[model samples]
Target: MLKSMTGFGSATQEANGLTVTAEVKTLNSKFLDIYCRLPRVYSDKEVELRNLLTQRLERGKVELSLNVTRLTDIRPGVTVNRPLVEAYVNDLRNTSQSLLLDVSDSDLFKLALQQPNAFNSEVSTASETAASDWEHIQLTALEAIRKCDEFRQQEGHGLESKFREYIQIIADRLTLIEVQDVKRIPAVRERVRNLVTELMGSDEFDQNRFEQELIYYIEKFDISEEKVRLKNHLSYFLEVLAAEEANGKKLNFIAQEIGREINTIGSKANDASIQRLVVQMKDELEKIKEQTLNVI
Candidate 1:
């Protein structure tokens, strides 16, 4: 089975008065590249989360975001620094007195709270609660990855079908080339004979020499080997596509080989009809190459 590198997945779970949502989106890339957005409290887990993504996804430009929201009425743990607030208020009162301006108590208190570290966030004391929350986040992330894989699998099916179609079209063109090739050789021989006779201005061309020259010329244009190699490459491509493991890079390499054979055949075809078929093969191969980028 083949897999596509493009996919999207997301999961959400609520536990311990916290709602965690994980989202993962991926696009085709030659290597694994991960970008993560984690809440500040969970920032320390970024490396672990990255490793998890690497283990699951072999290759892609991956974007992962984790959103932690407090669902309950209770806010995150925070406590006011009473001493800091009192000092700030004293400073504000002195400044107001010097400026001969009146300051409301509520306004002073609000301004004091806006200063840095005016409040401290209390770390959770319950180890089990923290552990459970982390576990929930991990599970949510794994579920998102699982869904992404499923998306890739579904897209892979479509890609497989497209590949089969393109390969078949190229195969059909190769068949047409073979049909035209049969007529090409004899026609080329006759044309060469006529041209030689015309140049000599008589039917005095040496039979032995002419035969030798014709044999060499025909050998140069012989695409039999190229045709066979191309067929084999095409067949091998289909075989790899049907394999159990994902092999996008291998398939790309095979596509290059297939292109090489097609180009060789085109350069040596010599026949207009065969050249046209070669052009069609090139077009189909280009499509295959484009689609192969999304394969895994």
Candidate 2:
């Protein structure tokens, strides 16, 4: 079965006063392009995380984010800058006195806390703790990637159904052309005979020469070879669609062959009904091409 390049998944794990959340989103792309955002403590592991994502997702523009939050007061990493807070509070008091204004202590404290450097959160760098935390993050990330694959699989099923529908439509159109093709040769012969008679008069027109030229002209418009080739290409396209591996590029190449045959038939059709059928086939093929871009 095929996979789609568009999907999203997220997972969160909590342990040892740390809550880690992993999120992954993907969009269609010709190659694997991964972008990551991780907490400062895990910055060194960014390359490992990227490798994990690349291994799971073959092709797409992938955006991954990891968020970590501390939940235990006993292990709090954040500390208030007492000297900075006191300076802010004292400055606010002096300004209030100079302006002859009254400010509550609670208000002054709140304003002081909002200043830059009032508090700082220390990033944990202990090798043992980092290793354990990385394991938790890795498991969470893998879970998110698994969910992403599940989503892609679901979308792939939908794409496969659509491809079958479009292929069927094109096949039906070819059948219609086959039926209409029978009347085409005779109509061309008769039209050529009438034109020759009208231009040179029946007595002047050479029957033997006209017959030879007519055969040549009609052969130029013969779509028998094109029809057979198009049918074969369509069948091959469906065969590849059911393969075990994702062959989006291979399918695209097959679609191009289908289009080449369709274009040849259209150019040589010289009949209104066949031309219309060719147009419809082109429409269906265009839809398939558009959807194939999302396949993996």
Per-candidate TM equals 0.78, 0.76
Tell me the spans in candidate 1 whose CA falls farther than 4 Å from its real position: 73-124, 194-212
* Model 1 TM: 0.78
Top-lDDT structure, candidate number: 1
lDDT per residue as tens, model 2, 177-234: 9999988978977877786677467566777877777777777789999999999999
* 115-211: candidate 1 lDDT, tens digit per residue: 9889976777455567788999999999999999899999999999999999999999999999998999898778777866764675676778777
